[model samples]
Target chain A: MSLLEKISDQATTLTPGERRLVENVIDSPTSAALGTAGELARAAGVHEATASRLAKKLGFVSYAAFRDALRDEFIATRETATRFEKTIAESTSDTILGELAREETQALGRIEEFITPEQISEAAQILMRARRIFVYGYGNAEVLALLMVKRFRRFGKDTHQLGTDPRGLAEQMLGLDSDDAVLSFAFRRPPRGYAALMETAKEVGARTVMIAGKSGALLTPRPDRLLAAPRSGDQDAFQTLTVPMTICNAIVIAAGLTAKEESLKKLDRLGQLIERFE
Target chain B: MSLLEKISDQATTLTPGERRLVENVIDSPTSAALGTAGELARAAGVHEATASRLAKKLGFVSYAAFRDALRDEFIATRETATRFEKTIAESTSDTILGELAREETQALGRIEEFITPEQISEAAQILMRARRIFVYGYGNAEVLALLMVKRFRRFGKDTHQLGTDPRGLAEQMLGLDSDDAVLSFAFRRPPRGYAALMETAKEVGARTVMIAGKSGALLTPRPDRLLAAPRSGDQDAFQTLTVPMTICNAIVIAAGLTAKEESLKKLDRLGQLIERFE
Candidate 1:
C-alpha cells in the first residue's frame, strides 16, 4: 500500500499525539525535517520523544527515516500542491511564467489537500440519483463550471450550466427538490445573489454542493455540503487562482467513477441527444 | 541551462539528417530506442548510416547512449505530468473526474506539443505596449475574456472583457486602433454575432489575437494574433477542453511581467479608485 493509504488506515488507531505528529509532518514536512527535534516538536505541539516515536510507529527505523518518508510523501504530493500554506507562500513571483507556474502548481496543491475519496463517492451517488443537475459558474469560474457540465452530462446525468441570470438561478433554486442537486463553482465570496439562491435551494430541499473559500455564513444554509477551499484572491480580478478549481476537478472526476450503472445508461442516452444537437 | 536549452542550441547547427534524427528521438524516445537502425532510419525517412553517424557524432559511444539521452529528455518532460496525472487518472471512475481529466490532459498535451516561446513573447509584447486592450470571449470563452480584464487591469492596463452583448462589445471596439489591440478567444465556431464584432474590431484597425481551434477561415473575423488549440469535446458534450484558456493564463502572466513598470503604476491608481468605490 502507498504510505498515504497506510497513514489514513492507521489514523483512527493512533493516539492524539500520533495524529498531530502525522498531520503536522504531512502539512509542513520541510520545516520539521530541517529543524531540530525539540524545535520541530514544539512547533508541532508534541513532545520530542513523541515525534521520534511517531516516526518508528510509521515504520521508520529512526527519526531520520520518518523524515525521509515525509520527504517522499512531500515529493509525491507536490504534483498538486497539497498544502494550503505552502501554496500561498509559493504564489509570489516576478515573471509571467513565474506567476503561471505558481498558479498551476497551487492548483495541484489544492486538489490533493481538498478532495476526498468519500466526497467523490457521495457526490457521484448524488449526481447519479438526481433527476436533473444544474451547474452554475460565472465570471472566471465558468470554464470549470462548464467542464463539470460536460462531464456529468457524459454519464447521462440531466445536467446544464445556465446561471446567466441571478433571479433565474433563485427561481430555479425555489423549484428544486431533494431529487435534484446543484454543483456550483464560486470562490472567495460568490455574488450576493448566490447566497440567496443557495438558501432557497436548501429551503426547497435540494441537495446543493459548492466549491468555495472560507466564508461560513454563505454556507450556513447547507453547511453539510460545502466544499471549502483555502481563500485566495487578487483584488479587482474576477478570476480566482486555479488551485481551488483543480480541487473541484478532482472531486468531479471521483464522483463520475463511483456513480451507479443506471446513471451511466442515462448518460449514454444524453450523449446521444447531444450528438443530435450537434 | 536545462536539457531542452542544450538540445535546442544544438538543434540549430545540426544538418537535415542529424536534425531529423534528433527531432524524431526527442519526439518519441521509447519507440526510437528499441527499433533497429534500419527501422529507425526508415521511421525518420533517412539512410541507415545517417542515423548511426548522427548518433556517434552526438558523442554517444553506441546507439544506446543516444537513445538514453533522448529518453532522459522525454522523462524530464513527463516528470511534470507525474505530479498530477496518476491521481487524476485514478479518479476517472463514473464521476465527473474522468471527463475533466481526459479534457484538461488533452488540452495541456496539445499546449506542450504546439505552443512556441515566440507566440508567448509576442502576446506579451502586444499587451505591454497597447494603447488600449479590449478582451473578447463568447459563450465558453467569455470566462477567460473577463479574467484578462481583471489581471491586465491589476497591472494598470486599460483592459475590458464583457461580451454578453455583441452590440456593447462592438461599440466598445469602435475606439480601437492600430495602436490598440483587441485580445479575443473563441473555440470551435461561435455565433455570427461574435464574428461580426471581430470584423468591426478589424474595420477599426484594432490588432487582434485569438485562442481558438479549426484555424483561419474556420473562425471568422479571425484575429491577427492566434493562439490555436485542438477542438476536442469531452464525453460528446459541447464543452471546450480549456487548452486555450490555460494558454490565455500564460499570456496574461507573461504580459504582466513584461509590462511590470506600467502595471505597477496602474495598480496604484486602481487601488485608489477601488478604495473610493469601497
Candidate 2:
C-alpha cells in the first residue's frame, strides 16, 4: 500500500499530534518525501516525536525509513510529463474535446463525495460574518481570487485581492484584523507567500478558509476550514479549475442564501447602477 | 413560439446578412430589445436593411415590432431576484452543494453539443501560430484571462493580459498587429471597452477568438471565431464558470498537443526553474 493508504488504515489509533503529522504526509507527500521529519512536524504543528511515532505506527523502522518509502512513491507518481504523454496516446485530435468533457463531468460528479455540505455552510458563514475579506491566489489560481473578489463585492462585502509581492502582501495583511477573513486558493504546490499569509492570519486572529486541491491538506497550521479535492485525474495530470470553481459557486450561493434579503437588495442596487452607467 | 425558437426554426432560410442579425438577436436578446434596429444591424456587422428583412422573415411587420416583443420577453425572464428566490426555495443549506454540483455537471455535459472539436482545433492553431497573444477579460472574465495567460506562457508563447483602463488599454492596443491574436471572454453584458477592443483588433488585422456566455452572441462586428454556451438554468439564474473554464481547458490542452515537443521542453524548463527558485 502507499504511505497515504497506510496512514488511513491506522487513523483511529493515532494520537492527535500523530494525526496532524499524518495529515501533512497525505496532503503533500511531495514535501514529506523531500523534507526532514522535523520539517514535517513543524508544518503539521506537532512535535517531531509525533512524526517518528507515526512512522512506527505505520510499520516503518524509523522516520527516515518512512520518508524513504514516501520518496520512492513520489518519484513513481510524480511523472507529469508521462501522464500527458499517456493522455495524448489515448486521445486523438478528434476525441480530445469529448474526452476532456467526460473527465470534467466525472470530476464535478465526485465533488460531493469529497466535500461535505457542512463544510460549504461553515465557509459561507465565515464569509458572511467577516468585516472585510481578503482573497489570495497565485499563478493560475489568481483567476479564482479575482472571481471571489467580484462575487463578494457584488453582495456589498468589502473584498480585496492579496498581492504576491512581499511588501504589498505585508501591507494588505497589516490592514487585516480579527474581524476580517482570508479565503485562499492553493493547488499542487503552495504559493510563495502561503505560509506567511496563514501565519499572519493566525497571529491576528482572523478567520481563514482554504479551497485546495488534494495536496492542500498539508498546509501548515491548517486553516479554520479546508475544502480539498482532486481535479479529475491523478496528481500528475494537467489539472483544470472545475472542482475548485464549483466549490466557490456553492459557497457564494450558500452565503447569498444565508444573507438573502441583504444580498438581493445589494444585487438590485448593482442592477440599477449598471443601468444608469452602461 | 419564442422569437429565438422561430429564428432557429428558419435558420437555413436566412440570407448571410439576415443571418448575422438573427445571430445578434439570439445571442443578446437584451441588447436587441434595448437598442434600436440600426444599432442591432451595426452590432451584427450587417446593414440596417438586413435587420428589417430578418424581422419580416420571422413574420414580424417591422424590426421595431419584433424588438417590442423581445422587450416583453426580456422583462418576463430577467427577474434576477426571482431566480434566486426560486433556487433558494428549492434548496436548503443541506442540499445546496449537491444541487449546484448537478447543475454544473449538466452544464459541462452539454458543452460538446455547443462547442465543436473543429472550433477547439482552430482556436488552438491560432494560439500556436500567433506572434503574441493578448487575453481580454473584464470583471469576472479577468480571471479566465489570467488563467489563459498562465497556461499559454507555460507553453513558451509570448502572452499578455489586456488591462481595462482606457489609456492603458489604448496603449496596449497600439502594440497589436496582424501577427497577434486577442482572446476575450464576455458574458451577460459586454464591458465598456469591448467595442473598441474588437474594432481595434479588426482595424489592425489581428486574429480574434471570443469565448462568451449566451449574451455574447450580439458582440458588435463579432469576433473572428466565437464559442458561446449557456450556464445551466435560465439566463437570470446565477451562472458558474464551469462551461467557459472547460472550454479554456480544451483549448489549452489541444494547443499543447499540437506543439508537443516544444511545449514539453518548456514545461521541463519551468519545472527546473521552480525547483531552483521555489
Candidate 3:
C-alpha cells in the first residue's frame, strides 16, 4: 500500500501527536519528504521521537524510509502532470480543447482560497444595506464595475456608474454621503484622477471599497475595504484580471444569498419585464 | 490496497480495452460508477463482456461490487469536499484571506488550456509585424484596449485606443488599412457602436481579432480571429470576466516572448526615460 493509504488506515489508532504528523504529510507530502524528520515533526507540532515512532507504526523501518516513500509519491504526481502536458502538446485538437477545460476547472478550484463564503457575505451585507452604491472602474476594471452595477440594480439597489470623463466625475460624486458605499476597481496603474475620486468619496462620508493589486494597500488615504488581488508575474509584464473578477462573482453570489427574499422579488420583477419586452 | 491503487498496479498486465476502462474510471469515477455495464463498455470502446471481466480481475466478485467500490470512492471525495467547505465555513480571517490566493492560482492554471503556447506565438507574431495596431474596447473593454496599447507601446509598436464617442471613433478608424491589425474585446452587451467600429475596421482592410464570450461567434460580420472565453454562471446572473482577461494575458505574454530582444530594448529605453524624468 502507498504510505498515504497506510496513514489513512492507521489514522483512527494514532495518538494526537502522531495524528498531527499524518495531517502534515497528507497536506504537503513534498515538504515532508524534502525536510528532515526533526523538521517535519517540528512543523507538525510534535516531537522528533514521536515522528520516528509514528513511521514505525505505519510499517516503515525508519523515518527516512517513510520520507523516501513520500518523495516517490511526490515525484509520481509531477510525472503525471508532465505527461498530461505532453499528451496535449503532441495531440489532436480534441486534446487541445480538453486542456482548456482542465485549466479552467482547476482555476475554479484554486479560487476557493482567494474568495470565501464569509468575504462574500460581508461584501454582500455592505451592498445590501447601503443607501446608494456607486461602482467605478476605468480601463479594464470598467467592465467589472459595469457588471456590479447591473447585478446590484437587479436586486433593487440604486446603483450608479462613474463615466470615463474626468470633468463630469465631480458632479457625480456630489450626492454620495455617509449612507452610501463606493466600490471601485483600482487595479494596477490606476488612472491619474482615481485618488482624487476616492478622496472625494471619503470626504462625503461614504464607505470606499477598493479591488486592487498588492500595492494598493500602500496608496495614500487607504480605502475602507481593500480586496487585494496580487499580480502574478514580473512587474511591467502581463498581469491577470481573473482574480478580481472571481471576487466580483463571490460578492454577487453572497449578496443574493444574504438577501434571498428581496433579491428574488427583484429578479422575479425583472424576469417579467424581460418577458413582456420579448 | 485501495481499488484505484490496485488498478494502477495491474495496469501493465491489463489488455488495451481493459486499460481504456480503467482510464475512464480513474478520470471520472462519479460518472463511471453511475453508468451501466453496457454504457461503460460503449464509453470505453469495448465489449460488455470485457467490462465485466475487467471488474472481476480488479478482485470484484461481480461488476456490481466494482461499481459499489467506485460509488464509495465518489462519496468519499464529496465528503472531503464537504469537509473543505466546513473548514472554510468555520475558518478565521486569515484562512479567508488565503482563499483569494488559492482561487487566483487555480484560474491561472485553467487559463493554460483556453490559450495554447502556439496560439500565443501566432497572435504575438501578428501584433509584432503589423504596420499599425488599433486596440478597441468601450465600457469595461476600454481598459483591455488601453492595457494592450500600453504594452505594445513599450515594445515600440504604433498602437492606438479608440475613444468612447461615436464621432471621434469614426475619425480614429479613417487611417486604418490592410497593413494594420485591430484587437478588440467584444464582451457581452458590447457598446452601442461596437459592430459599426468592427465593420469600419474590416472595410478599411484591417485584420480584426476579438476576445469575446461564446455567443460572440454570432456577432454580425465575423472577425478574422475570434478567441472565445465561455461565461461561468447563469445567462444574466453575474457573468465572469476572468477567462477573457486571462486570454489578454496570454496575448501579451506571447508577444513579449516572441519579440524578446526588441521588447527588452524598448523597456530599457522606457526605464531610462522614467529615471531621467524623476
Clashing pairs for model 2 are none
- Per prediction, the TM-score for chain B is 0.62, 0.61, 0.55
Show where candidate 1 strays beyond 4 Å. Answer: A1-206, A213-224, A228-278, B1-95, B162-173, B214-222, B231-241, B262-278
Q: Which candidate should be chosen as best, given TM-score against the real structure?
A: 2
lDDT for A258 in candidate 1 is 54
Q: Cα RMSD (Å) per model? A: 21.2, 26.2, 18.5
What are the Cα lDDT values of the candidates? 0.57, 0.73, 0.64
Which residue runs does candidate 3 get wrong by more than 4 Å? Answer: A1-8, A11-116, A136-156, A161-171, A185-203, A215-220, A235-238, A259-278, B1-118, B125-177, B185-202, B213-220, B229-238, B254-278
Candidate 2 local lDDT, B122-234, one digit each (tens): 99998889999999988778888988998888878999999999889999999999999999998888876988999999998999999998777788879999989777544
Clashes of 1: 23
Write one digit per residue (lDDT tens) for candidate 3, span B1-278.
44544564565688999988876665445457555788889988999999999999989999988887765443222232344322323322123223333333333344444555566556777788899998888765665676678667777889988887889988888898989998887766666677887888778788878887767777877888777756443344434455666676556655655665433323224233322322
lDDT of 1: 0.57
The alpha-carbon deviation from the true structure for residue B26 of candidate 1, after best TM-score superposition, in angstroms, is 17
Backbone clashes per model, in order?
A: 23, 0, 17
Fraction of native Cα-Cα interface contacts (under 8 Å, chains A and B) also present in model 2:
0.34
**lDDT minimum window of 10 residues, candidate 3 chain A:** A262-271
TM-score of candidate 2 to 2 decimals? 0.62
Which structure is stronger by lDDT: 1 or 2?
Answer: 2
Q: Rank the candidates by DockQ, best first.
A: 2, 3, 1
DockQ of each: 0.05, 0.13, 0.05
